[model samples]
Target: MDLIAKNLSYKPTDQFHLNDVSFNFKNGNLYTILGRTLSGKTTLLKTIAGLLTPDSGEIDFDGKDFLRTPVWERNVAMVYQQFINYPHLNVFENVAFPLKQRKMETNVINEKVIDALKSVGLSGYENRKIQELSGGQQQRVSLARSLVKNAKILLLDEPLVNLDYKLREQLREEFKNLFSKGLADETILIYSTTDPRETMELNGEVIVLDEGKVLQVGPAKEIFENPNSLKVAEISNDPPMNIINAEILESEVSFEGISINAPKHFNNINNKSFKIGLRSSDIILNEKGYEFEVELAEISGSETLLHLKKGNTKLIMSIEEVMNFKIHDKVKINFKIEKAYAFNSNGDLASSPFRSKNG
Candidate 1:
């Protein structure tokens, strides 16, 4: 089912859970909600599930107000961070509970329950009690329950938070594969996470929320490479966009005691005082480029992160090659002039003819 929320805001204790959040969730797409704890990620998911109503907004499901419909008729299933199941009930009973509630035929329930368990890789363990299962198994059981319900909208609120690192990675793929089963006409997966890997695995549109405010919502590539505002730029995990103060003269840009030849487009900025952003991948350790001292180096397997300081300004750059410098090592940094972003004093990004805004 396609869901559309407009002007969604909720105020419980003078503090809002959502701040005029608006987005149209496509029918058959895996959508992820990314934010910190108090950023209203869970609250937004709950609002969609009909657990809590927005103080001022409307949720439309195919031109009908979801709020006006009864909660039971919303056709939405929610799987939270906790793996909740009937501890006394066996896996089969737990998986078949929703089907029994709907009073489906015995043969049909058996077919659907077995299908769900098989999708979660728990086909032969149906008679085992939930308490006898591992954390991952129990979480899979929870997922199975949601899947067996045949709900259109799947609200997963940090469902893999309790699993260990390895299991978390493993289950992430299993859950994603569940979407291909074709159970519903359209399944909209609303996953909430602060982990970048989860968002990376899903590889869909990402909505970054900060303290109950909607920072930005767009495809992952556009949001990462061409953020329209500073708030969105601050939450990027791939080396938060490089920002440095720079001044544009008649035909030159001066920064960090280095002046580079500026293009004619530099003179057309709407504002004077602006900051320039450079991606980590764009800068290199070229001897003929700008010079600086490497203050810190963080090694993360294949790629190395270098924290370089130019005078009092510090910048982060990532290199695919192995780290060759130690702490306090002086290195000359070079960057491609074509791969930079200029933003005005208001933090609004400046247009670059060389770079598309939707990159």
Candidate 2:
């Protein structure tokens, strides 16, 4: 099945709205909606699931209009951030509820329920009451319920948000393996997450949304490495991309009492002012670049994060190797021009010097 949303817009109030959002998704691939809180992630998923109507636009599945289709008729299963299983029922009954609703044979429902539970690593918890299960176990039961429905589209809205960090990590890998193994072949999975690392770990196509607007959509790595706008660059990074105000001079860009050679694509834009985006990993500690004082340094696992400042601009650099640098120490660093992203004064990406590598 293929899903398409054209010019979808929804406005419940002035503060929250979706504006002219659009996308094309095919079956057999996982698509992630990456955004922060109140960024309209849930609204978009609801619209696709036929739970909410778009103020203006159309939704089509395999070229068939589903704008007016009833939620039940859409053959979609949605799992929410909360564990939504029936509290009064046992795991087996909860997992078998959807099958029973469809009036399947008793033997078939039993077989399917057991199989689904096994797939989610809850093989022997069938008779356990929902109230007796841990948070993670309850979530597994919810996932089992969704799987038993055999829906063509699966919508997951931060399904792992309620689990502990370790459990969330485990389930994340399980979900990815399930999809990759073709267990859900021809099924369209739309997952929404606020964590950038989660989006990256899924290794799927990503749609970045903010303030109800679609910022950018592409492969996870592509979108992160070549964000099309300033908002995208900001939304795609966990620590946030380092943005510096710069003026495009005659062959160089000047900022914060320093000047650097302008990228080839920006040579024609001389005299224009723009914002440069540098990833924390792209900022190298070297002896041949601009000097800055380290305001703070933190060691996290095998990596070191140094907060450096020069004049009024603050930047974060992630160093994979161990460094003895401490706060108040002056260090020299260089920006990897090829990895830099430049946005115009209007916040749109103006130049990407290394985009061809992805092409």
Candidate 3:
């Protein structure tokens, strides 16, 4: 099934609203909705599930109008942040609830429920009571219940948010594998998350949202490397994208007490002032670039995060190996100019030198 939302807008209250959001998605692909709190991720998901109607615009599924379709008639299933299961029902009974409601044959329901349980790695736990299982296991049961329904669209609203760190990591890998293994090959999977890393790990398409607005949508890596706007560059990154204010001259751009050759496309931008986006991974520690003092050093596993500053601008760099650098230590750092993203004074993407090369 193909899903399309055109100019979707919703205003439930003054605090939260979805403004002119639009996107096109098809079955057999996983999509991640990324944003901070109150960014309308949930609202958008609910709207797609037919739980909330839009004040304007229309939703089309496979060229059919879904705006007026009832929630139950949409063939959609949503797994929320909370694991909701009947305490009195066993795992099998819980997963078989929907099939039973449709009056499916007893033998067929048993086969489907068991198959779904095994798909989520909960095999042989069919008779386990909901209250007797661990939190992660219970959540698996919930996922199995959703999978058993075999809905055309599956909406996961931070379903792993409540799991422990280790369990969340394990489940993330499981979910990714399950989706790729054709368990729901013909299903449109929409997963919501606040963590940018989660979107990267999923390695799929992403839609960046902020304050009820759709900022950008594309392949995860593409959006990360070539954000369409300053807001997109900010929300699409973890530790956030490092932004520096700069001024464009005729042939050079000046910022942080250094001048670099300007891209030819800069001549088209009407504004002289601009913001440069540099990902932490794109900043290199070398002896040939600008000098900056290390403000802090954070070591995590096999990687180190260096917080460097020059004059008034702060930059963060992630290095694979541990560096013996202390606070206030002066170090030379350079940028991979080809990887830089420039945004105009109006916050829209102005120039990307490497976009063509990557395209």
**What are the TM-scores, per candidate, against the unseen true structure?**
0.83, 0.87, 0.87
Could you tell me which residue pairs clash in candidate 2? none
Q: Could you arrange the candidates by TM-score from highest to lowest?
A: 2, 3, 1
- Against the unseen true structure, what C-alpha lDDT does each candidate score? 0.81, 0.86, 0.86
- Looking at model 2, residue 196 earns an lDDT score of 87
**Model 3: which ten-residue window has the lowest total lDDT?**
350-359
Misplaced by over 4 Å in model 2 are 62-64, 248-253, 260-271, 287-289, 293-303, 321-332, 356-359
Q: Scored by Cα lDDT, where does model 3 land?
A: 0.86
Mind giving the per-residue lDDT tens digits that candidate 1 earns over 4-98?
Answer: 98899998987888999888998878778877778899999988888988889889987779878888999899998998899989999999999
| Superposed model 3: Cα runs more than 4 Å off | 62-64, 248-253, 260-271, 287-289, 294-296, 322-331, 356-359
Which residue pairs collide in model 1, if any? none
lDDT of 3 by residue, 113-181 (tens): 989999999998988899889989988888899999999999999988888878889999998898889
Model 3 clashing residue pairs (backbone): none
lDDT for 48 in candidate 3 is 93
